[model samples]
Target: MKRRDAYLKLTRHNGRAGTHGTYNPKHNDRSFNLANSEHIDPERAKGNIYWDCFYGFRSALAPQDPDDLAATFSEVERQFYESRYSNFVESQNERNAKIRHTERNRSIPDLLSSRKTCPEETIYQLGTLDEHASGEVLLAVVTEFIEEFKARFGDHVHVLDWALHLDESTPHIHERHVFDCENKHGEVAPQQEKALEALGFELPDPGKPLSRRNNRKITFDTACRKMLFEIAKRHGLELEEEAEYGNREYLEKQDFILAKQKEQLAAQQNKLDELTLKVNDMETLIDEVSAAAYDKAVEVVTDVVRTETRKEDMRMIEDTKKWVLSPERKAPQSTREYTAKHLDSVLGQVPQDHADHRCPLAGEAPEAGSPAERQGADQGKSTGFCSATAEPLAGRADPTKAICAAYRRKIRKLFSIIVRGDVY
Candidate 1:
């Protein structure tokens, strides 16, 4: 049995980053500038090509372009913010577009950066570089695997792009895709744990809370590995389900050698050099601590002021609430209710002869037998607001009703202002 291994990793780098450029030599600046580098053989690099993302068969292979993937990312992100976070955009201006904070706050790149898991890369290879399966067989398996992958995760995971590289030590496919789920605002945003959860993936340790060791992504990756292994088995290549340690184990021969050399050199460093490094690190730490302490002190003082201000405001609100809801004080009423319920009580508060209490034309008390005069006589009081003296209008006006309406309007306005905390 020719036992191979399955390789998959969820990297922090998003599609637009330099990693995509490295995967496709056409987009790599280093490939153009440093063609002599051992990592990529110029002649063999010609065989590497991007996946044909079209409906019909292509005459030739499509060349990999990072800009195409980046454009897709940009469009998706633009729609997400424009559709769901319109409030955040509306609150912004030319001066504070980047500074404004709200409930749905995020920067332009946050759609990519804020995600816990980013684009994942899956490599389909038989074995180590020195011993591996034929390129034709690997290609066929990977092509079928990509189809299965799309069917499995197409909903939550979007395949941005993939490339088949023939320039590397072994033939493999470098496929990249982002995970996303609908956020609270109904926007499909790039998120890892939530996306996986939406896809029905559970934590590795169901009993424990989600953490670095007990994440749902860990379970997700395991399922992907199993799928890859099963697909490889179907294609007549037996794959090893054994786990690999060290992230750098999959690097190219030249890069691996350089990494080992760096490790050896670090191990062989002189004590004097190590001491000097520690002393510099200590100085840097001290500077950081001093700056952090000053910032924390300022934050504490500002919080104290804010807390006291809030306490005073709350106290004022409570006082207003008590006065407004008191049983002894009459709640605000309409003009008709005020006249019927508190007409006598309110009239007694003001003396009949007070200039302000009297209407503009106090001399025009209605004729004794007039309806207005009879109403006042029945009340048996001269409260000045009696329609007899209070009518600002000519003969036919009822001034008591007019005064009650004005008072009702003023009372409503005052209550509204108090509830809004605008009294201060």
Candidate 2:
């Protein structure tokens, strides 16, 4: 019979013939004859000859189908051992029942009370060592896997938790998956599964017990190192040989660089604050200067107006003196003196009529005429004097012109208060 057919027939018969002993009957006799013919030493006789015959028997019964015999053996062993081990089976059953009860009673509202909900499912829990790898690369691979996983599965899956445990013997991630029972919208589950598939992880069977799954007990130290390297390769984020060492020197250098950058940023911020304060101070100073300049300009203009008014009044008095003392009004000295005294008395009593009275600069004398004639002569002279001097004083281009021009120049200077530009 062919070796493969013989093994298959033996398996189908439920026979125990080949489980312990060799299937081949002639192998022992053949080895004994070879040892006798070679005159082998006794110690060698007990070792080499026995081992060769044992291996020969094993080879004859070994399956040649190229299937995973180790996996098949493990399954068969589990089934056989579980059937025979009643105590172990009962313990496992009790554990599974408790887990199922917990899952059924747990509500999403209860979970949300203590934990924040994330949009995506199948969160990639990474170790601190894993985070030592490039974050950009890790996130890229993880995101791609999440997308692919969602495409394959529905959107009922959600990541309930993702945490990196760094303060342990082996840095690892703790991840929790929550199946959305109320996933009518189907937005979260499908995309999450798709992303997981892209990351090359086997899809987890929801019906399986949580304790039986490989993901439940995953630790950063015991995780698939090869898979992490593959993810790095996909994203082109592999670290250099020196970086992979993770030595103290490298860590110190990184710290120094980061500290320097922080210091530089702080300095720049401080400089900006100082500049802002300076600008505010300058603005306040400008306002003060502007107020002072405005007040000074007003005072100067008021003084100019008063001085001009006084000079105009003096010129009018001088014109009146010229008109009243003219040769046309010549009179006796004694009569002029008496007329001057009466005019002064009237001018003092009625200050408002001083403008029309005889000028103070006129000689203290009355003209040679009757009382009515003197009065008519004084009235005629006053009108002529006013007409002549009014035109000269009021129409003169230079009248108080210098004072006004100076005031305008001072006003322009005051208005030139410098104001700073605005900060961005």
Candidate 3:
């Protein structure tokens, strides 16, 4: 979509930069006739479409009264100088440095070098009214651009005064703003609040190129060119490309946004990977701890069994269990006989007697001569084989039983110790 030649030029002036193009608000009043062009009749367009001016910050818009153009310039000029001087004083105190002219000798009169030269104003000439644009449309585009600039930098950087010069050779705007420099002669008055610094559109040092290939400075002229191009494109006006915009000129808006999103996605992926690794580490630690706890419990139970039974007796009991349960053994007539026989077999085999036995009701094996022992000793059937009781004891009723009504319980108590030891 090719359009017209969109041109933007900025003229910066100060006390040091020769006063030929220096801007003064009083200049408008002195040359009041020249403020408006010969095309528009001043008498007819006096208060209506003659000139539209906006002063002060963009947020707090201060419209100039049509009846008094002189008053508007006077007020803004005073405030601009005042704010600029106040800011200059603060900067000087903070840095505590003096502006010295190394090239100029002390004997030579360098009057302005010692003092501040701030409250600098820049004159802007946007694209001229092209063939496609009417006077009204061109002014509207200029107004939109002014508003955009203010919104972009208004909070931090102050726009003291602004106006559209409709009577000029082409439709253009003149805005005077102060910055982080020193005072300009005695012409500056201290306004209450001064801006911190210009946010965007920083102008390079005077005499430097607007768009330098080597230097990466984004200057005010460059910003204006971009703004003009965009506005022209939107208004469907023709745009003549500048030959020296360099690489930055070819950059597209969509490409910039996509690049930013790509960066964000990569950062997010890195964060997710970090979290996943932490979670995996935690899971591995938990599994190791659980395995350790289980192994510790098994070890504790095995230790208890070793303490209760000697190695020899344990070996005998294991052999007897395997033999008794074997299909070929034809295990005792019933569970009662089986219990008696198994207990007798295990107790008689251990050399130390009953290392695994502990019974409160039956004490010390009945002195080794009790009738219970006499019966087993005389019959040669078992050792201490009690015949009075055959009933199973309190602990293992589920796996064993007794018989012979009278001797069942006594038999049960004798074998009860043997059964208890097997559990551990």
In the range 1-424, model 3's lDDT, one tens digit per residue, is: 2343344322222231344533454433223564355664444323222222332222112334456533555555554444445544444444443545333322111211223232344444434344234446655665676678667755544555554444445544455544332234432323212222224333355456533431222354466568756876676655555432223554554576677688899999999999999999999999899778756644553343332323323333333344434445343446535654666665564445444442231232222332333434433322112221212222323111122222333444554554553321
lDDT per residue for candidate 1 within 395-422, as digits (tens), equals 4334344444454344334434433432
Off by over 4 Å in 2: 1-190, 193-265, 284-292, 308-424
By TM-score, rank the candidates, best first: 1, 3, 2
All candidates' lDDT scores?
0.51, 0.36, 0.43
Judged by TM-score relative to the true structure, which candidate is superior, 1 or 2? Answer: 1
> 164-191 in candidate 2: lDDT tens per residue?
2222333222223333322233222212
10 residues in a row with least lDDT, candidate 2: 7-16
**lDDT for predicted candidate 1 compared with the true structure:** 0.51
TM-score against native, each model:
0.44, 0.22, 0.35
